[model samples]
Target chain A: MAESSRADNRVLLLKLGVIACVMFAFAWALIPLYRVICEVTGINQLVKADAPAPAVAASDLAVTAAPVRLRFDATVQAGLPWQVRPLVGQMAAPRGEFVRVDYEITNASNREVTGQAVPRYLPAAAGNYVKKLECFCFRQQVFKPGETRRFPVVFVIDRAMPADIGEITLAYSVFDVPGQGAS
Target chain B: MAISTTAGHAPHEHGKPTGLWRWLAATNHKDIGSMYLWFSFTMFLSGGVMALCIRAELFQPGLQFFQPELFNQLTTLHGLVMVFGAIMPAFTGLANWLLPLMIGAPDMAFARMNNWSFWLLPPAALLLLISFFVPGGAAAAGWTLYAPLATQMGMGMDLTIFAIHILGVSSIMGSINIIVTILNLRAPGMTMMKMPMFAWASLITAYLIIAVMPVLAGVVTMVLTDRHFGTHFFNAAGGGDPVMYQHIFWFFGHPEVYIMALPAFGIVSHIIPTFSRKPLFGYTSMVYATSSIAVLSFMVWAHHMFTTGMPATAQLFFMYATMLIAVPTGVKVFNWIGTMWQGAMSFETPMLFAVGFVCLFTVGGLSGVTLSVAAVDIQLQDTYYVVAHFHYVLVAGALFSLFAAIYYWFPKMTGKMYSEPLGKFHFWWSMIWFNVTFFPMHFLGLAGMPRRIPDYALQFTDFNRIASIGAFCFGLGQLIFLYNMLRSIRHGQAAPHKPWEGAETLEWQIPTPAPYHSFVEAPHVEAGDNGVIHSMTGGAHH
Candidate 1:
C-alpha cells in the first residue's frame, strides 16, 4: 500500500510539473495571440501602420465639404536639448483634401544629437481616420550642433471622420536616442 | 541503525539535536515551522515600518517628509514585502506546522526541501530591502512594475527581478511539498473527502502557485530582455504595445490575489465552527466553494485592466465574470453566520478576529463588486478607492485571519496561554484603527485623489490627516500583539491538550506542544454522525 501511494505521488508530481511548463508556454504565446485577437475582432484600434492604406474612396474624397480647422503642437522631452515648434500653428483645409504642415527643429546642444518624435491625435479615437503619408516620426532625425531643419507631415482627414469632430489637433513629442550617432 | 535500536526500548525517546547548529541544519517540521513563523513576523514589522513612513509623508501633504522618488520606493517595497514576505510565508508556516498534525502523519513528505524553501525567503527579502540603499534607490514603478517604466529603472530593478525569481522558487517548492504530503501521507481511511478544510485549501493553493509562478517568471524575463537585449516587448517605438505587458501580467496577478485569500478562507472556516461549538455548517459546500473561487479567479484577470482601454465586449465579459465571484464568496459568508446561529458561541480572541474577517472581508468583496462594473471601474481604477478596497481585503481578510490562526493555535504550538485581556485589546484596537485608516480613503478616491503621488491638492488635506493618524495607532497596536506573544512564550501558564473545549480536530486530540513525531502510530479515523472525522483511539482522551 505504501509503495503504491508513493508511486501515485510521483505520477501526480510529474503531472503538475508538466502543467506548469505548459502554462509558461501559454503565457509567452499570449503576446502574438493578443495581436491576432485584435486583428480578428478589431478590438483595439491599433491601426497597423504597415498595412496598405485602404484604397482611398475616390467618391468620398471628391465631396465638396466645409473647411475644418487643423492645429499643430510640438514639444521636446526635457533631456533632448532641442528647440522644436510647428512652423505653421494652424490651418484651414477642406475635408478629404490632403494638407501638409512643417515643424522646425534645431539642435540646441554643442554636440550633434539624434531624436525621435512620437505622434498623438487629440481625441485619440481620431487616430484611425488620420493617415500619414510622410512624417519625421517614421525614422530618427540627426541634427548637427545649431543646425535647423524643416520636418513635414502630409495627411488627409478622411471624410469618414465624424462631422462632430470639426477640429483635429496633431501633436508631437521628441525624445533623445541614446546609442545612435548623428547621421 | 543505532537510533532505531534505542527507539525499540523507549519508543518516545528519539535523538534530538540542540542549539544554533540544530536550527541551521534542521529537517524537523516543528523547528522549521517555528523559524518560518518568526521570519514572517520580522518581515511583517519591516513592511509595517515602511507603511508608516508612507503615512507620515502624506500626513500634511506637500511633500513634507520625503521626496517623491523615496515615497514611491516606500510604497513599492511596502507592497512587495507585505505580499511576498509577510502574508504568503505566514500561510506556508501555518500549513507546515498544522497539516501533518491535522492529518495524523509523522511529518512533511519532503522535510529537507521544506527547510530550503524557508531559507530562500530571507536572502530574497534582503535583496529587496537592500536595494533601498543603492545608487538610484529601489524600483519605484509601483509593485505592479508596469513596463517601459520598469525597463528604464536602474540597478535596483534587476535586484527586484532576482528577488522575485527567488521568491517564486521558494513558493513553488513549498507548494509542491504541500501537494505531495497531503496526497500521499494522510492516515488510511482519512480519504480525500475527509481531510480538514485547511489541508484542502492548501492543496488548491498549491496548484494555483504551480500554475502561475512560472508565468510570473516568464513576464519578468521579458522585462529583463527589454532592458538589456534589443527587444521591444513593451516599447511602442519598437512596434510593441505597452498594453500587451498588462495582459501577461494580470494573468498571473489575479490568481495571486486569491492565493493570498483562499488560505484565509480556510483558516476562518475552522475558527468559526470551533468557537461556535457546532460542527461546520456545510463542510462539503465550503470545500466546493473554495474550489469554485479558484476556478473563477483565472477568468477575471482582465478586470484590473478595464480602464486600460480594452474593447467594449472584452470589458463586459470580464466585468460579468468578476461579479460572478461574489456568488461563491457569498455562500461561504452565509455558512459562517449559519455556523454561529443558535450555537452556544463564545467570544475569544480568535473568534473575535474570525467574526471581524467575515464582516470586513464582505465589505471588501462588495466594493469589489462595485468596481467590477467597467463603467464605475473607469473612475476608480488607480484611485485611492482601489487602495482602500485591497487593504480591506488584504489587511482585514488575510492579516486578520492570520492573527486569528495565531491565537487559535498558540497554546497547541507553544504549550503556553497568552493573556486574554491583552489579546482582546489587541484585536479591538487593530479592528477599529484599521477601519479608521482605510475607510476615509474611499471618500478620498471618489473625490478625485489619484494614488502613488506623494503630495495631494490642498482640498484633500483633512482626510489624509485622519488616515495618517489612524495608521500610526494601527501600527502601534501590533506592538502590543508582539508583546503578548513573547510574554506568553516565556512566562505564561502551561496549556492543556485541548484549550478550547468545543474543538474537534485531530490537532486537539494530540498531546500539548505536540510531540517531536506526531502519530508515530497512525490514528484510526471514522466519520462520525456529524460528518466530522473523529479518531476512535484519538477521541478516547475525551
Candidate 2:
C-alpha cells in the first residue's frame, strides 16, 4: 500500500509540474495573442499601425458641404536641437476631401541626427475619423548637419465625423532616436 | 511497507535534534508550520510599520515627513510584503500544519522539499528589504509594477523582480507538496469527499497557486528583460502595448485574490461549526462553491482593467463575469450562517473572529460587487475605495480567519490554553480599530480622494486624521495578540487531549502538542461516517 501511494505521489507531482510549465508558457503566449485580438477587433487603436487608406471614388467626397477648419502645429522635443514650424497655420477643407499641409524642419546640431515624429490629434477621438494618406510621422527621418527639409502631410476627414467638432488640430512632436542611423 | 521503513526513523523514536538545527533541517510538518507562522508574523509587523508610516503621512494634507518618492516606496513595499510575505505564507503555514493532521497522513509527501520551500522565503524577504537602501530607493511604481513607470525605476526594481522570482519558486514548490500530500497520503478510508473542509480548501488553493504563480514569474521576467535586455514587451516605441501588461498581470492577479481567500474560507468553516456544536450546513454545497469560485476566478481577470480603455463589449463581459463570482461566494456565506442557525452556540474568541469574518467579509464582497460595474469602476479605480475594498477582504477576511485559526488551534499546538479574557480583549480591540481604520476610507474614496498620494486636499482632512488615529490603535492591538500567544505558550493552563468538547477531527484524536510522529498505522474509516458525528457519539478510535 505504501509503495503504491509513493508511486501515486510521483505521478501527481509530474502532472502538477507539467501544469506549472504550461501556465508559464501561456503567459508568454498572451503577447502575440493580445496583438492578434487587438488587430482583429480594431481596438487598442494607439498601438495598431495606421492602415493605408482605400481608394475613394469622386462620388464619395462631400465636396459641396461646409468645410471643417483644420489647425496645424509642430514642435521639436527638448535637447533635439531641431526646429519645426508649419508652413501653413490653418486651412478649411470640405469633409471627405483630401487636404495637404506642409511643415519645414531644420537641424541646428553639428552632427547628423535621426529622429521620429509622433502625431497627436486634438480631442483624441478625432484620430479615428482623420485618415492619413501620407505623413512624415510614418517613419524615422535622418537630417544631415545643418540640413533643412520640407515634409507634406495629406489627410481626409471622414464625413462621419461628429458635427459638434467644427475644428481639429493636428500636431507633430519630433523626438531624437538614440543609437540608430538612417535605414 | 515503505511507510514502516520511513516510520522507523521517526524523530520521536530517535530523539529529535534541538535548537537551530531542529528548525534548519526540519522535515516535520508541525515544526515547519511553526516556522512559517513565525516568519509571516514578522513580515506582518514589517508591513504594518510601513502601513503606519503611510497613514502618518496622510494624517494631514501636506507632505510633512516623507517625500513623494519615499511615500510611493512605502506603499509599494507595504502591499508586496503584506500579500506575499504576510498573508500567503500564513495560509501556507496553516496548510502545512493542518492538512496532514486532518487527513490522517504521516507527513507531507515531499517533506524535504517543504523545508526548502520555507527557507527560500527569508532570502527573498531579505532581498525585498534591502532594495530600499539601493541607489534609487525601492521600486516606486506601486505593487502592480505597471510598466513605462516600472521600466523607468532603478536597480531596486531588478532586486524586486529577482525577489519575486525566488518567492514564486518557493510558492510553486510548496503548492506541489500540498497537492501531492493531499492526493496521495490519505489514510485507508479518508476519501476526498469525507476530508475536512480545510483540506479541500487547501487542495484547491494549491492548484490555484500552481496555475498562476508561474504566470506571475513569466510577467516579471518580461519586465526584467525589458529593463536590461532591449526587449519591448511593454514598450510602445517597440510595438509593445502597455495595456497588454495589464492584461497578463490581471490574468494572474484576479485568481490570486481567491488564493488568499479560499484558505480563510476553510479555516472559518471549521471554527463556526466547532463553536456551534453542529455539523456544517450544506457541506456538499460548500465544496461546490469553493470549486466554482476557483473556476470563475480565471474568467474575471479583465474586471481590474475596465478603465484601461477596453472596448465596451469587453468591458461589459468582464463586468458581468466579475459580478457572477458573488453567487457562489454568497452561497458559501449563506451556508456559514446556516450552520450557526438554531444551534447551541458559544462565543469563544475563535468564534468571535469567525463571526466577524462573516459580517465584514460580506461588506467587502458587496463593495467588490459595486466596483464590478465597468462604469462605476471608472470612478473608483485608483481611489481609496479600491484600497478600502481589498483591506476589508484581506484584513477583515483573510487576517481575521488567521487569528481565529490561531486561537482555535492554540491548545492543540502549545499543549496549553490561552487566557480567555485576554483573547477576547485582543479580538474586540482589533475588530473595532480595524473598522475605524478602513471603513472611513470608503467614504473618503467616494468623495474622490485618490489613493497612494502623500497629501490630500484640505477637505479630505478630518477622515484622514481619524483613519490615522485608528490605524495607530489597530497597530497597537496586534501587540496584545503577540503577548497572549507568547504568554500562553509558556504559562497558560495545561490542556488535555480534546480541549474543546465539540472539536472533532483526526488532529483532536491525537495526543496534546501532537507527537513528532502520528498515525504510523493508517486509521481505517468506514463509509457514511462523518468524523465529527462518529467521534462525538463514541465511535472507535483506530
Candidate 3:
C-alpha cells in the first residue's frame, strides 16, 4: 500500500511535468512557426528576400573601353601543395556589364590533379552575377607536374548590381580532385 | 535435518522464467514487442553511424576528401536507412512490443504471422547494405527513388526494389497483426476506451500502415515492372505522368510521416506521467488527437507537392488542411504540459532525455508547421531548410524519445543502471551540439541553399561552415551515447527491483534481472483503466 501510494504520486508528478513541458515547447515554437506559415502562405510577408541594389555609376550595360592591360597581385596558399597564380586584375565596368578573370595552376602533388576550379562569387552582399563561361567547376581539371595552365571565367553583373558593389570577390578552390577517402 | 524446499516458496523462483521465452521464439504479442524494441535500438545506432558519415564528409566541403558519388550515397542512405531501417522499424518494434504488453493480452492475435513479420527485416537490411557493392554503386536516386533517374540506375536498383518490397511486407504484416490484436484481444474487463494510450496510437498507426505501405509497395512494384516488364507507370514518353508518381508517393508518404511519429506521441504519453508525478492530463483528448492527426494525415498529402505546379485552389486547400493539424497537435502539447504542471520534477537520466525530447521535438514540430504554408515551403522546400527541419524532427523528435525510453526501461531489460553521469553527459552534448548543427541550416536554407548539391555558391559559406562545425560536434556527441549503451549493457551498476526512483508500470512489477518467462501466469492487473498503476499486490509477479 505504501509503495503504491508513492507510485501514484510519482505518476501524477510525471504526468504534470510532461504536460507542462510539451505545452511550453509547443507555445514557444508557435511564434516562429506562425512566421514560417506567414512566410509560406504570403499572408504575412514579414520575411522578404533581400533585394539587390541598382547601380549608381554603371547605369550603362556596355563597357566603354576594350580590355585594358590588367594584372593581379598573386600569392600561393600557405603550405599549399598546389601552385596557384591569379591571372586577372581589378577593372571598372558599367552596370550589367560582363567581365572575365583567370587563374593559372600546376599540380604539386605526386599524383595528377584533375578537378574543376569551383568559383564562389561574393558579390558585395548586394549584387548578383551569372557565369556564362567557366573552366573547371562541375566539370574536371587535370594538371601534371610543371603543367602550367590558365582557368578562365566569364561573368556578367545584372543592372541590379548595387551601387555599393565596388568590390566583387571571387574565391575558387580546386576540388573533388578525387583524393584519399579521408572524408 | 535436511529440509526439502517447498514448491510454492522457492528462492525467487530460480530457473523459472516469467514467459520471456515466448518473446524470443513464439510469434506472440509480448515477444514481438521485446524484439521490436531491441531491433529498433540496434538500427538507431547503425543509422546514427550513417548520419555521422554525412557529417564527416560535409565537415569541410571542397571535397575535403571524399568520393562525390559515395557522398551522395551517404545522404541517400542516411535517409533510407533511418526511415526504413531505424525509425520505421523502431516504431513497429514498439508496436510489436508494447501494443500487446499494454493491451491486456497473452499474445498478438496472430502469433506465427508475427514471427514471420519480424523475420523480414534482417534480409531487407542486408539487401540494402549489399547495394553498396552492386557494380556501379548503391541506389543513387534516394529512398524516394523518383523515376527516370531511378530507372536509369544499374543492377543496384534491383536490390533497392527488393529491399523496399521486404520492408513493405514487414510493415504490412505488423499492421495486420496490430489491427487483429486490437480488435480481438482485449480482456473481459478492458474496453477500447479503457485501453492504454499506446494501444490507441497503435490502432491509428496500424490503420495508416495498412493504407499506405501497400501504396508504397505498389509503387515500387511498378518500378520493378517498368525496369523489367516494360510497364510505364511513371514514364511520360509512354504516356505516364512522373508527377502522378509524386502524387501517389506523397499520398502514401504524407501519412507515412505520421506513421513514424504518432507512436512517438504514444511513447511520450507513457513516459511523462511515470516521471512527472501526475496523471496523464488529457487521456481521452490524446486519443482523439492521435486519431485526428491520422485522419488529417491523408488529406494533407498534397501539401508536400504544392510547389510542383499545383493549382492555386488545391494549394490553398492543402495549406488550410495542413495548418488545421496544429489544433489537435496543440491539444497534445497542451496535454503534456498539463501532465507536468507543478509536479515535483526530478531529473533522472530518463527524465532529462524526456525533457530534452519535448523541447527539441517541438522545435521540429513548429518548423513542420512553417513548411505547411505553401509560399514559404516554395523557397524552403528543396533547400537545406527542409533538410534541417526534418532532421530536427527525426533526430531530436523521434530518436531522442527512443533514448528516453531506453533510459527508462534499460534496467528492466538488463538489470543494470547505466552510468547516470555518462547518460547526462551524452544527453547535454547531443542536445547542445544538435542545435548547434541544425539551427544554422535554417538560415542557410532561407538564404537559398539547395540540398543534395555537392557544392554551393560562395556567399552561403559562413553559415555552411558554422553548420559543418556543429555537424562534427553533433556526430562526436553521439559517441558518448553509443558508449553508454555498450558499457551499461555489459558492466554498469546492478539495478534494484525498481530502477527509477518513481516509476509505476506493469513492467516494473517484475524482479530485478527479470525472469525469462515473465507473465506466464499473468499478474492480476488492477491499475486504473488508463495504464496508471493504482496498486496491486504480488511479489515478482511470477
> Taking the candidates in order, what DockQ does each have?
0.31, 0.39, 0.02
Residues A1-183, candidate 3: write the lDDT tens digits: 324433543454344335434433443343345447656877533234675443545434334223222223333322235676676556654444567777777766775555444444544243234445554455665666456777676666555443345555555544323463122
lDDT tens string, model 1, A17-45?
78878877887888999889888888776
Q: Candidate 2 or 3, higher DockQ?
A: 2
lDDT, residue B20, model 1? 89
- Summarize candidate 1's per-residue lDDT along B505-536 as a digit string, tens digits: 77887889777766666677775322256654
The root-mean-square deviation over C-alpha atoms between each candidate and the true structure, in angstroms, is 4.9, 4.8, 15.2
Cα misplacement distance, residue B277 of candidate 1 (Å): 0.8
Where model 2 places Cα greater than 4 Å from the true spot, the runs are A37-120, A124-138, A141-183, B1-13, B527-542
- Model 2: docking quality category: acceptable
Error of 3 at B510 (Å): 3.5
* Candidate 3: docking tier: incorrect
TM-score of chain B of each: 0.96, 0.97, 0.91
lDDT of 1 at B157: 93
| Candidate 3 chain A weakest ten by summed lDDT | A64-73
Which candidate wins on lDDT?
A: 2
Among residues 3 or more apart in sequence or in different chains, the pairs in candidate 2 whose N, CA or C atoms overlap within 3 Å are: none
